[model samples]
Target: MQQLNVIGLDQQGAEKLGKKLNKLLASYQIFYMNVRGFHWNIRGERFFELHVKFEETYNDLLLKIDEIAERILTLGQQPQHTYSNYLDNSSVEEAANIHDGRECVESILNSYQSVIRLQREILSAAAEIEDEGTASLMGDYITEQEKTAWMLTSYLK
Candidate 1:
């Protein structure tokens, strides 16, 4: 069998980073599901425009979900994929039963902020444990979610 290629992570540090990574992954999954809901249910005076915009936004969030899931696996953890896991693990709420355009916007903006906060915590954990790779990953997530939340919040105003 090949020896492990991952470098410099002691057991405790790696485990800490893995836990942070799984939380981030779960948050990404929740954000992605919420975006998909808005993409399908967005109907208003800007029906066509918002529908198209939601599609693009949801697609972007979907890609981030994939990246975060794979990052968790790279850290040697299984990704949380089931609805049960999501409902239990996610602080973000489901976007169904929402009828108002501004409501969807508000919910999504909240999700964006939540993910960004998670990213910051992850980055801090990784740095505290001296895991450069996971820290870098969390930094990228922070930037992504911050920019997304800024855009969505602006639209919501």
Candidate 2:
């Protein structure tokens, strides 16, 4: 017989989801730091605009990071808290010295692509196990990220 967690999700399936969420969490942490760098190091004529945008993006990423960590806790797993773990598990690259506005935007776009792809995978896995909480979380993230990606892409053109 399959055991269930406090939230009524199958213990085994929730563990799988927790592992996936840890990877996503790692990616967000790296992306958040990258955006922080972009926010601080950005230069050129568009500095003011890009700085504000980067700050907003990083702030939003921070919120998602907390939410993801809490979800992992809810799933009966501990969130990986070390930078080494984040570096080892993350799919998102840690961008550095990206001072140019266009370069920063491009980096952000690339990170979004990686994150959104992973989110879609999680969404599918969650659906397979009838985990609406995880599915809804991923769905909301993907939708918001898609819109942000479009806007960033438009800025590049």
Candidate 3:
């Protein structure tokens, strides 16, 4: 008989899912830090508004990071927790010293695009293995990120 994970997902598939989720976790860590930078350094005419928004964004990213890590654990794999590992594995690059509100918002939008794409890929993989837990998580992230992207784009316009 084939082995299955805690959630009844095929063992091999669950392992793959856990790896992908770890990559996602890495990306979220970098992105979360970047958003925190944006919140702290954002200036110019939109400082008051953008600062608050950036804080909200970083807080949300923090929550998602925790969720992704827990999901990896649920899938029977260890989540990568070191900054070195995150920097090495994540596609999202770290942003430094960004002060302009528009530039920071633009960077956030770009990062969200990358994350949303990855989540969609995860959704597909999870669906293939009938891992409803992962599929649901990815689906929720994609939906919320898409709407946030739309709002950020409008803010930029």
Q: Report the error of model 1 at residue 10, Å.
A: 1.9
Q: TM-score: which candidate is best?
A: 2
Return the lDDT, model 1, position 125: 80
Global lDDT of model 2: 0.96
Task: For candidate 3, write residues 15-81 as lDDT tens digits.
Answer: 9999999999999999999999999888899999988989899999999999999999999999999
RMSD of 2: 0.6
lDDT of 1 by residue, 1-157 (tens): 3233266556566666677666666766777777777777777787787777778878887887788777767666677778777767776777787756788889888887777777788888878767787788778867777887888878877
The per-residue C-alpha lDDT of model 3 at residue 114 equals 93
How do these models rank on lDDT, best leading? 2, 3, 1
Off by over 4 Å in 1: 1-5
For each of the candidates, give the backbone clash count.
0, 0, 0
Worst 10 residues of 2 by lDDT: 94-103
User: Model 2: which residue pairs collide?
Assistant: none
Across 134-157, the per-residue lDDT of candidate 2 in tens digits comes to 999999999999999999999999
